[model samples]
Target: MADGEPPKPPPRLEESVKQSQLSPQILYSDVVKAHSQPYSQQPFELNTIFDAESSALKEISTYQGKPSVVFPFSDKQVLVEKLKYVLVGKFSHGRPPMDTIKKFFVSLKLKGDCNSTIFDKKHIFIECVCKEDYYHIWLKLKWFIDGYAMRVFKWSPDFSPMKESSIAPVWIRVECLPLYLFDEMSLLSISNSIGRPISVDPRNINRTMLHSSRICVELDVDKPLLDAILISFKDEVSKNILEKFWVKVFYDEVPLFCSFCCHIGHGTGTCKRRLEDIRSGQGKAEILSADKVFDNMPQAENSTNSTKFVAGNCGSKMGKQIRPSMEWQPIGKHVPNARSDLDNKVAPE
Candidate 1:
């Protein structure tokens, strides 16, 4: 293709997407192989350097004529005494507390959630701004707000199974939209991803004009991973709107490895429970079987636990099956066994 020319369909758009050339794709092995520095047993020059660096940071952040440090000393408030002089002393020595700096952040309502007493003491408000990086900053800021809400506003924790609590969003996008854009199949997958609070709104359009159709996701999770996942998901959604429209997702931070181990990561086979299916002589490993009954089971909804055995409804369906035994005895039908009639072993001895 000439300069300014977009490349033609390379026969397999899905494969092309899997090989996206843009960002660094650090694999699990890569992270595991990185070198880590050992902790020192004794105080070294590095401690001095860190102290000096902290001092410099405080120097740049001074707030008032009193030489109030931008960063407070490790401790600013006292267990029992007027603390202003101690803070002043630390600021004089350029050793404002890192803990106090965090307090300052909360006071400014810069952290997640908004109702913490510190925020009350500091006072702040929430606002939305549209800009180049609005989406990214918005996700981060939401988490901070949500955190504040939980701690100070008395909102429930994000992951806890509680109503009235604030929550992180779960970002979801299927890259195979070109193949199954608005089908029930993809919608169910999206629902599985939204987790507890958020809901899914599917795209309604016929196949002929699906290219012009668009899919929108509103979730409560973190941003960066959501954005990264969306990039990969572009290959999944086959809508025409995606041809020129940039795909984006932003939600709260969800740990990639933990989610992966919980069977929320890529491809179903690597899931531990999925592996158990193979060990138990279930059907072979499958990506999308025509009759993936387990996948369709209502019990499978939004479950992070994959270790549980998937016991199917054998012939009698859900009711318990009675085991046949030659020694079977109906309730109060038979006399006690000879062993029960006999005295204890010590009594016999």
Candidate 2:
């Protein structure tokens, strides 16, 4: 049985499972290969995008049956450096100052440093800045743009894929892009000027886009009007006529009585001027005033005192006069003010 020959060991699993560089997988394969190799060793070129002068983008795009998503970028050297940093590394320090970025670039101007936008995201209908010659830069940064798109929106950027903006997530549309993107010059001038320049990538929406165009992004919002609509939408009995009621008839800058009574007519019985008017025969008042003239006011009846004081129930002493209030009973059944009047009448002066 010819068993003398030594059998070769099984091939290394490392070689068997080794990944590939290209099968026309487009940006995905590029990232797979780039990440497969150490980030420290992968070209790390910040200047020119990979294969800027080749039709490789078209071939790879066709191989995957996807179109190239164009991204517009600014000519500002600051954006170029920032974009370079994003391409070569992650966005550290979050949002840094444009001046600081520009200052850095001005200090260390790199050779052939072309400005590229981080549209790292694209959707169906192929979002882009409607800027002049945007297509030029778009074709240049095709790989990075598509890679960013995959990393951001969680799906490949597709023009006329399946759904339109009318079908996208509400938070993705209203809050994210137009509202946030309109404010960032990085997106406004470089990315498309749609309602929300801020966009979720078709591939991965987590990776944020650093640059966009302001021309198409309509970020302006009528906040007051929008709030009004929301308020109306949240309409309830709270906004009803009786009182713009909060928890228990809450009051504002206006006086408590005035606010409750709509600030126009008479207030609570605590009104002092109304009491005087009732005494002067201007109107027949129902609620008796604390300062009313009492028949039991023999004490201060002829006395030359404009008013005398009488202690009330809760330390809130009321003004004493010839007239007595019938509406409010004293703390005790007996009238304390009456007793005071009796004592005052008996005393001289």
Winner by lDDT: 1
Please report, as a residue range, the 10-residue window in candidate 1 with the lowest summed lDDT: 83-92
Per-residue accuracy of model 2 over 1-349 as CA lDDT, tens digit each: 3589788788786755554333334677777787799757877557855877776333333336766554334334544443221221112124333344334333433433423333222221122223322332222222232123211111122312222111111112212122223334433232222233433333223224322211222221111001000000123756432211000000011112221112112234545656576778765543344224321222211233332222211132222211332121221123211223222222111
Model 1, position 163: C-alpha lDDT score: 21
Which regions in candidate 1 have their CA more than 4 angstroms from the true location?
1-119, 129-136, 141-165, 173-349
Residue 138 lDDT, candidate 1, scale 0-100: 29
Question: How well does model 1 score by local distance difference test?
Answer: 0.30
Model 2 / residue 305 / CA error / Å: 63
- Model 2 spans > 4 angstroms off: 1-101, 105-198, 203-218, 222-349
TM-score of each: 0.19, 0.12
lDDT of each: 0.30, 0.28
The TM-score between candidate 1 and the true structure equals 0.19
